[model samples]
Target: MASDLVELDRRAVLTTMATAELVTLDDLSRPTPCAGWTVGDLLAHMAAQHRGFAASARGDGADLAHWHVRPPCPHTPAEYAESADDVLTAFAVPDVLERTFALPEFGPEVTVRGEQAVGFHLVDYVVHGWDLARALGVDYALDPDAADPVLRIAEMVPDGPDRDAPNSPFARALPVDDGSAPLDRILRLLGRSPTWPDRPDR
Candidate 1:
C-alpha cells in the first residue's frame, strides 16, 4: 500500500534539516555544493520552498510572488524547523494530494498533478539534504522507506543537454559507480558530487 509520499518525504526532509539547523552564524558563510548558494542562502531558499509549497498545496501556486528565493535567512534553527513543520502540516490536509500543482517556476505553461509535484519536491529535498550534509561535514542517512520512493522518482529525471540550462530543475545526471546506495544514486542523478568538500571532519 502507498503511504503518504509527501509525509514520508517530509519526515526525511526534517531529519536533514535538523542537521542544517546546527549551522552556526559562521557556517552561514560557508559555500554549499549547490553552485553559488551559501549555507545561509540554502536555508533561506529551503524556507521559501517550504512556504511556497505549502501555499501551492492550498492552490496558491499560480502566484509567482510567493516563490521568490530571498536573501540569506534571518531565521534561527528553530524557525527553520518550524518551516518544515508548516509544510508537513500543509501536505497532511485532507485531499491535498488529490489536487494539481501549478508550478510556474518550472514552466509557466505546465502543471502537475499533486503526487507528481510531491515527487518533484521529494527528490529535490533528498539531494538538497545531501548537499547540506556534505557542507556541514556530517553523514546523512535517510530511512530506507524514504530513500526508496525517492529513487523511483529520481530516475524519471532526464539526462543530458536540457539539464545544462541555468534554470534546469536538475543538472545532467552525474555518472555513478555501480551498486551505489539508493540515496547516493539519487544524489548522482540530481548531479551532486557525493564526496563533496572532502573535509577531514566528514
Candidate 2:
C-alpha cells in the first residue's frame, strides 16, 4: 500500500462528495476556506474541475471551451457526486496515465506529465475535502493510508514567488510551523489556514 496515489485520490474525492451531501441548502451560502467562494461556489468549482480534468484525460485539455466553470445554476448534491465519479472513471481508462495533459489554465505551453497531473488533482481534492468539512462544521479525517502519498504530492508543488503571479492556481504559500500535523502542513503549503473560520478577527 505504499504510495497508491490513484486510490488515495479516489477515496478522498468520494468521501468529500459524501460529506458535501450533508450540506443543507442554507449551508450552501456559508463561507469556505477559499477566499471568495462559498460552499456552493466550492461545489460548483469542484464539479467544473472534475469535468475539466476528465476532458484532459481524453486529450482535450487544450480546448479552452472545456475549461470554463459552468454558469451558476441550481444543482443537487447527487450531481456533484456524479461529477467526481466522472473524473475517476476517466482516469481509470486503460493507458490514461501515459497521456500528457495540456493545462491551458496554467499557460498554453504548460503541459503536465500524466502522473503529475493526477497528483495535482489528488492534492486538490484532499484540501478541498477539508475545506468542505470545515465549512460545514464537520470533522474531516483523511484516511490513514493517505498521509505519506498525499505528503509526497504536496511537496512536489513548489512554493515561493512562483505562486504569487496574478491568476496563479495557488495562493502564495503560508508559513507553517515545524512539526505541524500532516494535514496542517498540507493546508499551509497550499496557502489555507487550518483554522480558517477561527482566524483572529481583523
lDDT for 43 (candidate 2): 86
What are the lDDT figures for the candidates, one per model? 0.75, 0.80
Q: Give the range of the ten consecutive residues with the poorest summed lDDT in model 1.
A: 193-202
lDDT of 2 by residue, 38-124 (tens): 888888878878888888999888887676767777555666888898999988876666679878877877888777787788888
The residue ranges of model 2 lying beyond 4 angstroms of the native Cα positions read: 1-3, 160-169
TM-score of 1: 0.88
Number of backbone-clashing residue pairs for each candidate, in the order shown: 0, 0
C-alpha root-mean-square deviation, candidate 2: 2.5
lDDT of 1: 0.75
Candidate 1 residue spans exceeding 4 A from truth? 72-79, 167-169, 199-202
Best by TM-score: 2
Worst window of 10 by summed lDDT in candidate 2: 164-173
User: How many residue pairs clash in model 2?
Assistant: 0
TM-score of each: 0.88, 0.89
